[model samples]
Structures are given as C-alpha cells and as structure tokens.
Target: MRPFHYDKPATATDAVTNFRPGAQYFAGGTTMVDLMKLDVMKPARLIDISGLEKGRYDFIKWSGKSLRIGALTPMTKLADDDKVRARVPMLSDALWLAASPQIRNMARIGGNVLQRTRCPYFRDTSYEQCNKRKPGSGCAALDGGVTRHHAVLGTSDKCIATYPGDFAQALVALDAVVEILGEDGPRSLRFADLHVLPEARPDRETTLAPSDLIIAFSIEDADFPRSKYLKIRDRESYAYALASTASALRMDGNTIADVRLGLGGVATTPWRAREAEAALRGGPATEAQFARAADIAFAGASTTDENAFKVELGKRTMVRSLLETARMEG
Candidate 1:
C-alpha cells in the first residue's frame, strides 16, 4: 500500500473533520486493505474509526419490534446474535453465508455494505478496460465474457457488475434503514433505496457522498408469519451466490395476508421483487401462486446472453423461499 497518514477518531464529529479531499475511512481493514494492497484504493490518509462506544456493534437493541446494529460491529458479532437469528434470521444467515469465519472476524458490518465489486477486470487493472473501475476505459464483460453471474434486472452498456453481498438482500426484504453521519448531520435512508440501479450511470453504485460515514442499521420487525432466505451457489460453504431469495409471508388460514421479498445474485443491486410480493398478497400461498408471483417480479427484466439462467433460477429459488416462509399448512 502507498504511504498514508493515519488518524483514529473517537467521535462522529472527529471522524467527519478528518475527511479530506482524497482520504478513506479504515474500519475492519478486510476489504479496504485487500484493495489498498492491490493499489485500487490509494488514499493519501487513512482514518481509523474502529473503536467508539456509541459506535460498537450493538445487537442488544434488537427486539421483535425494532433492531439497530452499529457500524463498527464485526460480522462475527452479527452472525452470532441470538436476537438477529430469531427476528430477522435471514439477515443473520446471510452474514454466515458470506466469506469465512476468520474474514468475518475482521470484517465490519458497515464496511461490508461499502465494499467494492467482485468484477475481475475491475479488481485487477491489468485488463485496462473496466468502466466501473475507471470510467471511459470501457467494459470487458459487455463484449468479451461469459457473464453467468452478471445482472439480469439492472444493467447498462457500460457495466453489468453484480452487487455481491448478502446482508443487503435481507435488509431490502425487511425494509431496513441505514444511519449515516455527515457534515450536514446524520440522516436515515431506507436500505432498499440506498443502492442505485445501472439505469443511467453504471459507474456509481450508491447514494452516499464522499464525506459520509455509516453509523448503524435499523430494521423494523413484525411477526412475519414466516420468512426464509434460500441461497444457491456452486458449493455449500465459502462461495458466492449463483441465485438467492429472501421472502417473508403473513398467512391467514389458507390465504396470504402479506408478502415481502428481495432477490440477490441476479441484479445490479438488492433486487426487491415488489411485483412478486403484490401478486402473492391477498392470494393463495400455493406453489402455482408463488410461481406466478415470482414471474411477475422479473417481467420487466432485460436479460443478457450468459445470465439468462438467472431468470429461471431466480423464479425457482423464489418459489422455494416462499414455500419455506409460508409453511403451507395442510
């Protein structure tokens, strides 16, 4: 990594003051350090924001009604929290489905959301043609690639990179909110609205400005009659998702009262299948209804050559997730 000054701030004000034109915050240093070593993140100064009392990973605030997780909270802490497991179990399971134990130990909850993409050409500049890594350089994945893992929901001619994270998927499903601190003061955003699709500019991924710092995340909880996260990857452990779905259902007798869903591994962002949710709402919870609902979610998707598999896989995965969440009592 290039030479950089280090500052450790104890307060949000201190952290904001330390932000300069070309500086980056250092939290767990798992993803940041990896990119720094690769020369992709060459910040002139590094502000260490790992330790703060109000900033610690605080899962104890979680009840069945509300949940708040601190920014500096380690992924390990979240994956092990009993409350997270019970209320939003899908969120906890997504953390467990990420990297590995050791990596998770060093990865922070906030940093995980801000981590860069897994696009090969972007990660290694030797390709010299990833528009997202360096705009106007052009996208290699667009013309010369087998983009099996690329996006089917959100894509542009410039970049079709997938948002490769698990936690955000469940966050979208539960309608979570993210807490960010900035010079303008703290503000909250619906987690589903945080990420931007590749409609116009594929270069940018989120709404966060340069000087903003994430503090915590809150998810409102209801006794969603049932919910589940179903992930399909090449392997069971230590692998990125090929397709995944998060679904929560409220059932009344043999009918569906309400439905919530968010999809991953097939879109440019946390793909919220709102249409699917609508289709299932006030309808039966049978396999056919679930399948139809899943179909509605992707009716507007535009597929590419290699990632067309995602559409079918996504539909099937959505069905399985719904079935598990609905419990489908006989």
Candidate 2:
C-alpha cells in the first residue's frame, strides 16, 4: 500500500470532526486495505474508527417486531446469532454465504454494504476504459472484454459493473433503514435508497457523502421466518455470485399475502424487485406464479453478448428462491 497517515479517533463525533476531503474511515479494513494495496483507492489519510466510543457501535438489538444491528457488528456475530438464524434466516444466510470464515470474522456490516465492485476493468489500473474508476473514459467491458460477471438489469451504455454484495440484497428486500452520522448530524434513510443506479455517472455508486458514517441498520419487521437467500455461482464455494435472490413470503392459506424480492449479482445496485413482488402478492404460491413473477423482474434488463445469459439465470434464481421460501414450515 502507498504511504498514508493514520488517525484513531475515540468517538464518532471526533471521527466526523477530523474527517477531511481525502480521508477514509478504516473499520475492519477488509475492503479498503485491499483496494489500497491494489492502488485502486489512494487516500491521503486513514481514520481508524474501529474502537470508537468504546465499542458502542458494535451490538445487536432485537425486539419482537424489529431488529437493530450496529454498523460495526462483525458479520460472523450476526450470522451466528440464534434469533437471527431462526427468525430471519435470509439475513443470516446472506452473511454466511458472503465470504470465507476469516473474512466474515473481520468484516463489518457497514463496510460490507459499501464494498466496491469486483469488475476487472475497474479493479485493474491497466484498463483505461473503466467509467467507474475514471468517468468519461468509456467502458472496456462493452468492447469485447470479458463480461461474464457484469450486470444486465441496470446497465447503462456507460457501465455494466454489478453490485457484488449478498447482505445488501437482504436489507433491500426487507426494507431496512440505514442510520448515518454525518457532518450535519445523525440521519437515516431507506436501505433501498443507499445505492444509486449507474445512469450517467458510473463513478458515483452510493448516495453517501464523504464524511457520512453508517451507525446502524434497522428492520421494522424481523419476523420473516419464511424467507431465503439463494445464490448461484460458477463454483460451489469461495466465489462471487453470478445471480442471487432474497425472497420472503407471507402466506394466507394457498395464496401469497405478502412478498419481498431483492436481487444481487445481476444488477447495478442491491436490487429490490418491487414489480416482481407486486405480481406475486395475492397470487398463488406456485411454480407457475413464481416463474411469471421472475419474468416480470427481469423484463427491463439490458444485457451484453457475454452477460445475456444472466437475464435467464436471474429469473430462474428468483423463481427457485420464491418456491423454496414458500415451502418453509414457518
């Protein structure tokens, strides 16, 4: 990694106060350090906030109706939580399937959700045509570059890099709220609104400002016992997903009373398939209905030559997740 100054703040207020235009918060450093070593991100200073407020940001609070998880909580803690595993298996499963055991042990939820894309053109400096890395430079993946892992659902002519996180998909599906501590003060917003589509500006990924620090994530209704996260990848383990779905259902006899759908590994952002959920709600919880909903989910997808198959793969992943979730005893 390039030489950079480091600072450890004792509290959130101090961290925010010390923040500068070229400073980055260091938590678990699983993602930031990797990018730094690769020279993909070169910050002037690293503000270490891992021990801020004497670990006040590391916690899990679950009520019968809602769940609040601190941003600094490690992935392994949340994934292994008894209540989270039993009541909200989708969230737990997403965390479990996100990375290896070592990575899970060190990665914080706040950093995981903000992890950058793994697109080859974006990660490697050799390519000069990554719009995400250098705006207006054009996208190399569009010009006969390998695009097997690129996005199809939210692709613009300027970029097709996919958002490669599993937990964020669950958060989007469950309508979780993200709490933030920024320069102005504390604020919260829908997790769905946290990430922005790469429309005209591929370099701009999230809606967060430079000094915004995520404090926690809250789910209003955490009783999704009939929820599941299904991921499809080139390999069985230690690989990024090609397409994945987070599905939750509320059944009323033979009909679907409520449905939630969030897609990952196939979109520009942690995708919430609101259109698909609308189609499945109040409909029969059958393969036929699920298949129809899946089709509606990818109806607006734009694909490249190598990533065209993702459209079909994404649909199948969604259908399977819905069917499997519907079969759950809870």
Candidate 3:
C-alpha cells in the first residue's frame, strides 16, 4: 500500500476541521483502503472518522415522513434489523447480496453507498493514463477498449466507468437522500444527484467536496406494496451483477397503480428507469406490459460492441423482476 498520513477524529466537527490538502475521510476503510492499496487513490492524508462517537449513529426517528440512518451503521446490522427488513425488503436483499457475511459485518452503510467506480483500467494504476486516477491524462479504456462492463448511461468520450455497488441501486430506487457533513455544514441531496455522470469531466465521481463525509442516507416511506431485487450475474452468489433490477409496484384491483424501477450493472450509476415506470404506472402487470416497460427502459441505452447484449439482458431482467413480484403477490 502507498504510504499516507492517518488521523482519527472524535467528532464530526473535528473531522471536518482536519480535512483538506488532498485528504480522504475513512469510515469503514473498505473501498478507500482497497484503492489505496492498489494505488488507485494516493491521498496525502487519511482522516479516520470511525473513531467518532458510536452513540451518534442512529436509525430511530420515524418523525413524519423520512427514516434516518447513521453513517457508521454496519450493512449487516441494517440487513438483519427488523425495521429495515420489514419495510424495505428490496434494500435488505441488496445488502444481503453484497460480499460475504464477514465483510458486511465490517462494512458501513455510508461507505457502501459512497463506494468508487470499478473500472479495471482505473484500478490498475500502472497503465499511467487513467482519466479518473490522473486527471486530463488520456483514458486507455477509450483506445485499448473492450468495454463489456463499462458504462452505458451518463458516459462521455473521456470515460465510461461503471459504479459498482448494490446499495446505491436500492437508494436510487427508493428515491433516497444522502446526508453529507462538510466543513461548512451538513447538507442533504437526492441519491440520484449524488453520483456525477461522466458527461464532460470523467474525473469527478460525485457531488461531494474534498472535506465532505457521508453521514447517512434517508428513505421516505412509500406505500408501494411490493418491491423486489433481481440481480443476474455469472454466479449464484457473492458476485457483482451484469444486469439487475430493483423494482417496486403497487397494485390496484389487478392493475399497476404505482411503480418504482431502478437499474444496476447496466449503466454508470444507479439508473432510475422513469420512462419505463411512467409507461407501466397504471397498466396491467401482464407479460406484454412488463416487456413494453422493459423496452422503454432500454430505449435510450447507448451501448458499444462489447456490451450491446446488456440492452436485451436488462430488458429481460426487468421483465423477470416484474413477473416474479407479480406471482409473489398472487
């Protein structure tokens, strides 16, 4: 691993105060540490926020509309928690789908949601031409490219990196909000807005500033009756998805009254398939209807030679999620 300075702060303010000069705030040390070890991230300093008071971590307040979660809360804790499992089974399943039981025990909810891109070229820094790793340096993936797992949505000529986390997919589907604590103050933003698309600047990954720490994510309670996580990968377990869907539906007397659909592994970030959702909002959840929505979802997909099959794969995966959820309701 690359050599770096490490600091542990007792409070949020203390952490913010110490942030700057190309430092990265460490929570679970899962992704960031891995990147540092791989030399993908070479920060001047590492501010360890795990030392912050554990009492500050909470998931209790169901005040009016939203549910608040603490940043330091473990993914396993959240997964096994009765409240989360009962309310958001889709989110629960996504968490359960990640890593192993051991890793999930150590990984924080905040870190999982704030994880980095999984581009092979970016991770292997020996290439010396990653736009994300070294800004303005040409991207090797663009020239020596076989972009089977590269980004499809929100990509640019500069980069086509894929966001490689499962929890963010659930967050986008639920229309969740991520809380960021910075040197200035705390702020809230929609999860969809948190991740930056590589439209122009492929170097930027998120809306977070240098000093900001992801505090937690909040999801408003929606009365959508059924939700499901359908992830298709090369294996049965402990693998990242090639095409996945996080879908929720509310049925009104044999028709779809409402729907929430999010795509994973098929794009740059947690992509909300609003066009597909809008088409099937009040339509019957029949085979043709589900297929039609899947078509709409994949309509705007801009894929290349390597991953063109993802368009069809994404549609089939979405349709399967809908059909399976509909059967479960019956």
Worst 10 residues of 1 by lDDT: 53-62
Ranking by TM-score: 2, 3, 1
| TM-scores for all predictions | 0.94, 0.99, 0.95
Superposed on all Cα atoms, the candidates' RMSDs to the truth, in angstroms, are: 2.0, 0.8, 1.7
Name the regions of candidate 3 deviating beyond 4 angstroms.
58-65, 222-225
> lDDT values of the candidates?
0.81, 0.93, 0.81
Q: Pick the candidate with the highest TM-score.
A: 2
lDDT at 140, model 1: 85
Q: Residues 1-330, candidate 2: write the lDDT tens digits.
A: 799999999999999987998999979999999899889999999999888898899999988769999999999999999999889899998999999999999999999999999999999999999899889999999978999999988889899999999999999999999999999999999999999988899999999999999999999998899999999999888788999999999899989999999999999999999998998888899999999988999999988788899999999999899889999977
lDDT of 3 by residue, 236-255 (tens): 88888888998888788779
- What does candidate 3 score on TM? 0.95
Stretches of candidate 1 above 4 Å error?
54-57, 328-330
lDDT of 1 by residue, 91-201 (tens): 777889888899899888898887777877778868777877677888888878668878788777778888888878888888889999988999999888788876556
Q: Which candidate is the best by lDDT?
A: 2
Superior candidate under lDDT, 1 versus 2 = 2
